[model samples]
Target: MTQATNDQFLLAARPVGMPKDSDWQRATPALAELADGEVRVKILYISLDPAMRGWMNDARSYVRPVAIGEVMRAGGVGVVVESKSPKFAVGAHVMGVMGVQRYWQGPAEDKGAMLAQVDPAIAPLPAWLNALGMPGMTAYFGLIEVGQPKAGETVVVSGAAGAVGMTVGQVAKHLGCRVVGIAGGEDKCRFVVEELGFDACIDYKAGPVHAGLKQHCPQGVDVYFDNVGGEILDAVLTRINMKARIVICGAISQYNATEAVKGPANYLALLVNRARMEGMLVTDYAARYPEGVATLARWMKEGSFKNREHIVEGFETFPSTLNMLFKGENLGKLVLKVADA
Candidate 1:
């Protein structure tokens, strides 16, 4: 790859299904000089999330979609190399929607709405982007606020070994719930139970998720933190307890589908069991991020929580590395190391 002054990926065209290389164009754009209350950051690590897939489409969502000819939107952690803002000083490490770029220049308040200073001393930079960042916030709020599992209740989560799911199962266990995870393979299922401390994990690859859930959860599911919607969601619906709370986090399984997202066939199960399934977008809980990060950070210090990140080296690898999430090649949160922090 040729060296550029400042590298960035811009959407060249809206993708039809899975994004292709042709969908984006890499450019070396010149940086703008900062304005008052503005700061410039050198991006260190860029977060690779399943949600980025939805952002590629020009659709109205909880947040505005990434537009054609615009920098592909992403969350990242960086250091304020230049600052004209009272909120942040030069050398301060910050995390925000910095997009897929080598450098970001903007008003502090504009980026800081979903941003916070990251202390590398407390946790490594990558860990911040993993457990203490957006993924952690999503799992924390989605499970605690939306799923609402109680002690002795059975909590089931799909995508149970990915970034959000890994945290959800651990949090539910900490709250005294019987936690069961649904993962794609034996290795992932094993990792969830043996490493992340879930009570049980059903291997969706081994058999039908409904059958596995029956064997694992003997008691009906009280809360379901759903990350991968599709057949797994419909399977979970079959065994929900009355008043079960379903936290709709993401649907990675259907992100690349050429057709519309698959609606749960057993949705009447929500009606039958009087359960409620509510969608969750992490940014809505931004106000409480400090509270979530503080507790999650403490849990990490005490070793009650585990954080995993599959670090793909090089900023140039974004185009190919992103497909890892859809292919289930990444174990936990997928992150791209853009440069040294």
Candidate 2:
């Protein structure tokens, strides 16, 4: 193959609030020759996630901060355009932390690379970034392992229209639980209930979450999957039944907050209810990804599960497109299309 160029977004500066264009710098660098056990992947679709906002802060977290001038950390699906590794063929499609770049050239075994081949035949390329990727894995393990909802119980998910939240609610329904979702708009709430088959969806933008929870969950909540933290989590806390399980999956509401993150004030409710609130990271269940993917895939094949993705065309829209998440502009999974597969 001929020499290639890689266009990328680098972390220029950390943001105090919501990220802006000034926080990122774009560059087109010439790709280096692949070494032994190395591969060059042409990124197709980049997964725009709420966790990315936390990754930008110059603070301690599960993953290291994206250093200045380094490619912005992002998970994406791509095709191996060039390869020197026997594990990957040049035409194979793959997914990993390929960064906010047009091309990714690195060692196949690089810890930072986290490369894995994905088959478009199993699901659409964009679906891999949404329901079948990290978000799906998060929903599966967080709900199943942490929340542990049984049949006849009630499961409530905040950010219910989002990638992870949508999956959580649907999976809970499949397990014979009553699923309710809390989202920002009537359209989103309608999508979760009408399109996604959620038992009910509370439009937090329309009214108070506490009231919605009280009305829909008269029996109280047996399991709560929290994607947006702050008031929603607090509201859910007040309605939790005895031995309730709360899975803290994310805090998208607090991701772009200028002030320190607000925690739930209803902590005493947990004590009074004998409930447990636990946090989960999808990476911890990396070893069992195949298991999770297979189960989610089966549901999709059976038409019992559905995935919705709001894809934005153009790599240039990275900054603004990502802001769509915090603003609740996108209906489902927010994805950035870099190139066609």
Candidate 3:
């Protein structure tokens, strides 16, 4: 076969607030031949997540910051075109931390790469990046393991129309809980309620979240799966049930703040309610990904769950496409399609 040219976006600089095109340096590097235990993959879809903004910061966090000149960190689904590893064969479809690139060439057991083969028959390739990918795992584990909602309880999820929030509400509904979503705009709220089958979705842009919660979650929130923190978290804290569980999944609202990230001002409510708030990193449950994948995929197949993706085509649209997340422009999971399966 002829040699492949790899186009990738490297971290050029860390931004103080929202990242811009200047923060990334695009480069086309010559692909190297696959060595033993290595494979070359043609990345198909790259996941656009809110957590990516945090990764661009220089400060310490769950994972190290994306180093300058290194490939911008991202999770993607791809197809293996060449393989020198027994674990992966040629023509296999896989997903991993392939980054904002056209291809991923790496060792089979590279922990940072986190490579794994995926089946399209189970769900479409983009769905693998949505419901069967990191976002789904984040929603499943964050809600089930951290939020710990019981049947007949009230569960509230911020960023309700986004990837993690959508899955969190759906999973809560499947477990027989009353699910309420908090999102911006009327259309997103409608999608969360009508399309995703949430009990109700509060349009934060239209009115106060506290009023919405009082109207929809009359019983008080037993479990709150927080994705977009800040004011929304403070609003939910005021209405949490006694001994409630609050899951800190992501804080998209504060990710692009130029100043210090805002903390929930109503945190004292947690103490008054005897509630607990805990943060979760999806990678923390990597060993049990199969459990989350199996459960979510089965629900998808059984017609009880649905996965949606807003795919922006083109390899060069990564920067603008990524900004869509913070702008509340995309419905469901936002992904960038670089190649066909």
lDDT of 1 at 133: 88
Which ten-residue region of model 2 has the weakest summed lDDT? Answer: 1-10
lDDT for each residue of candidate 1 in 96-133, tens digit (9 for 90 to 100): 88899998888888943355788998888888878798
Give the 10-residue window scoring lowest on summed lDDT in candidate 3: 1-10
Q: Give the poorly placed runs of model 3, Cα more than 4 Å off.
A: none
Ranking by lDDT: 2, 3, 1
Q: How does candidate 3 score on lDDT? A: 0.93
TM-score of each: 0.96, 0.98, 0.98
Our tally of clashes for model 2 stands at 0
Worst 10 residues of 1 by lDDT: 1-10
Candidate 2 wrongly placed segments (more than 4 Å): 1-3
Candidate 2 overall Cα lDDT vs. reference?
0.93
